[model samples]
Target: MTQNIGDALENSTSQASLAHSRKISEKIEQAIKEDATQFRVLTGDRPTGNLHIGHYFGSLQNRLRLQEAGVDTWVLVADYQVITDRDGVGPIKDRVYSLVTDYLALGIDPKRSTIFAHSQVPALNQLMLPFLSLVTDAELRRNPTVKSELEATDGRPMSGLMLTYPVHQAADILFCKANLVPVGKDQLPHLEQARVITDRFDARYGRPKGSDKRVFPRPQGLLSNAEMVLGLDGTKMSKSKGNTIELRMSADETAKLIKKAVTDSDRHISFDPVNRPEVANLLTLISLCTGQPQVEIADEIGDGGGGTLKKMLTEALNEHLAPFRARRAELEANPGYIVEVLHEGIARANAQADATLAEVRSAMNMVY
Candidate 1:
């Protein structure tokens, strides 16, 4: 009887686990759908260099999906933010336009999405002056992303702009009255700051018809399902590190980069990230591109050795990226069309920013 009871309990536990997994999946799909309604969404790249596949799967894909779902999307070319982490802006001056070209290459249709240079929207930054005082230095210090960035500088004193990047991000979101900000878990703190500042402003100024005031909707961070993709070297895939595969690269270039990627000395192709980070990382990259689950991919590649794994991964990545590469080439062939799209996106984004700024100014009693 005791053995029978144990079997029953095990079966019950297994069923419960299956139910929980299904529930979580449903919740995620529901959240994505829920967040897609009557919403203004803001997302962008820092434009440090050409974006890699990591950028596409991590954030850009989600942005594209949101736009397709009819969410009002704004893609910011974060030119100023790049200067926060780097020493010079010479390459950026040249590369920013390329970023827009790549955006056009991707499926970010300017007809539906707003794409613009961050610096051009001066009115957005104007809100930062009043919003800055609402948050604390300790709060900024506590932001994980901020700490990681500052630590990378070996404790070098940061610029005022660098220190207040979170606040600037807040202004970017609230300036468009964006209710949905798609971010990874790492960026949650900055979104929290946006919420805090919005609440503080509304509380201080928002009254009634004949009374006080309120303006911005405290934007929520619609967390991304995507995980942070590490580079070939098992570090963050960054252009400066020379570890990235640019989205605009040819199939030959993609294969070369993958072939050279670091993997374990062992011959076996197993997916044990904790024990073998290099092989596991490669496996994850392939899985991401192919939409296959990590475990299933590991099983299929089953002890095939590094050479075999690399070849398979190379094929998978190229196959997945070929369409985008072709599109990018076609788009690059016509610089005029790219320019028109960017200008049109800027006009739309500026209109939204201007309207939101007006509401903010009115709420703050800055204007009679």
Candidate 2:
């Protein structure tokens, strides 16, 4: 409530975006009078595992709204980053396909937007060279997300590919010349890096009297307002944590998971997340799924103990997931539809990436 709700909501529209939800909140608070319709948006996800409720509520749902709102949307699979961060790539193809299935199930029509894999379009990575030259090693080391990731991996830095992940992301956004990037609070630094790089590039080659040619636009953060949906264990809802509720989970599985969700022993059903993280998380999930306010939901469960709350949450979650499950089943049966959709996205995305790469090459005088 203390933050800018508008920017937060916009950032929630793109959690994986470079701008944090909090930054977006402030920007929106400041720019309340301007029309946002002219903006082109870019955001994406890593295909590390199955899509979950956190992703849906935090980002994908917002993407659907953006699409309907007439914003030009570009959603990338981020397959290349996934490979850079982790080791084994055995089931990479399956995960990418599953991600594609998620887009279709969530109503991300390929005809209305561009959706593509990071690896399929090779040109995007090439921009990394020029983009990287704009920043120093210390700058990369200072990035919070990058530092957190490196620390999380126990100081085991991956290959050069992983080290330069931010540049790749810059290429992703600059390729489309996006004006808006919907991201969560944690990713703001990356976007800032992109902004700095864009500015540097423009300054060096921008079209002034007796000046060079400009190639990119510095995009602003759209910041999402989505609250973090915690997993069963009160941590972020991630598949790696084994605490996520899969987007395509069956009604029975959802009920069972809700029932098993960690909650306090307190007999009261309240919205006190500080003391009652487990119960509060369940309430949060239910509220997100049911479109009911947390206080209203807490009032409904009033001191009935964990079982009653769990039961209520189970019912709400299952009911909420009914439509998505149905859609997922239909999409899963016709695997070719998913492939075709991605192929179409890949083609469209390639055109955009190719053009951006051409401009970069021309600006640097790389052409023969």
Candidate 3:
């Protein structure tokens, strides 16, 4: 009887998993059918450092697609969120500039997308107060992304700001009235919280169904199709790990880094990530940049071993990044160009954020 009960539980769990997957598929199909112009997408990165290839494939490239699809895209620098864990702001100014430059070089047209620093938008900050009341401390701590991030800090005590990171993100989404957010599977929980907060606020303060006073739109996650790009060490690509290839790195720098990448002694070239992570990582990088299948890459590098594979990867990477590097160099030479772009973004963002905040204040009866 005990074994029978366990089998039944396993079947039920499997069924639930199938249902969830079907639901996600339906959402993706619906999103594909929707008019892109109707989507106001809010997505961004923290200006902690230079973006890596992982960032390029994972989010930046998708942002370009969405922008070109006629979607109104807002890319936030999220500079304010940097203090949640770090003790002091280290080279934030330079990093912010680099982040914007990376975006532009990679095809985020400033005219088509609004790219602004988080700290520069005071109205977004103001929305946090009312938003805080809508979420609980327990809910904040339960977020998987927050939990994983804190765990990565090696037992560092959580800060108040860190605990409330999801709420702040909610403000970022709603302030712009964005109806879509681009995220990976791991970030779904963060987007879920944003949706929950929107529902609660709408229920509590929104007008009748027919009224025009509806404030926040429930933001939906537009899951990215890009596969996760692992670092040369076969771990998540991170700047702190010293394994990432930064977008700003020259061809020589990239080649030098790839040459030192870890790989196994297996005489055969294959794409088995389980046993041959290093080789698989190299293949994944090649496939992403070259638009080739991993199986094809494995076939091409047959029996040539890790040395030949690394050389091929280095060549492919240089070819892939050459245009981006040239464009970045041209933009970097005119440092004032970045400043002007940020200022324009700030102005546009402020106008939208201020309007949203005023509506929130009026809804909460805080406007005197």
Comparing 1 with 3 on TM-score, the higher-scoring candidate is 3
> Which candidate's TM-score is highest?
3
RMSD of each: 9.2, 5.9, 5.4
lDDT of 2 by residue, 1-368 (tens): 12332243234336454334466557753553365456678988988888988888899988887787777888999888876776767588999999999888888988888889978988877788788877767666556666667788875765677667777888888988887788766666677667778877775655433335467876877667788778988887778788978887888888888777888888878998888777888888889878899878899888898899889888888887787789989999999988998999999888888988878776766777
Better of 2 and 3 by lDDT: 3
Question: lDDT: which is higher, 1 or 3?
Answer: 3
What TM-score does candidate 3 reach? 0.91
Candidate 3 clashes between residue pairs 3 or more apart in a chain or in different chains = none
Stretch of 10 with least lDDT, candidate 3? 1-10
Q: Is candidate 1 or candidate 2 better by TM-score?
A: 2
What clash count goes with each model?
6, 14, 0
What tens digits encode model 3's per-residue C-alpha lDDT throughout 1-368?
11222232233235564456347746754765586677799999998888999898888888888888888999999998999888988999999999999999999999999999979999999889878877766567667656677788787788888888888998888999998888765566666677777767776776433457678887877767788778888888898998899989989999999999988898679999888888888998899889999879999999999889999999999999999999999999999999999999999999999988878877776777
Give the per-residue lDDT of model 1 (tens digit) for 290-331: 889777887887778788888988999899888888888887
In candidate 3, which residue ranges exceed 4 Å CA deviation?
1-34, 149-156, 208-213
| Per-model TM-score versus the true fold | 0.86, 0.88, 0.91
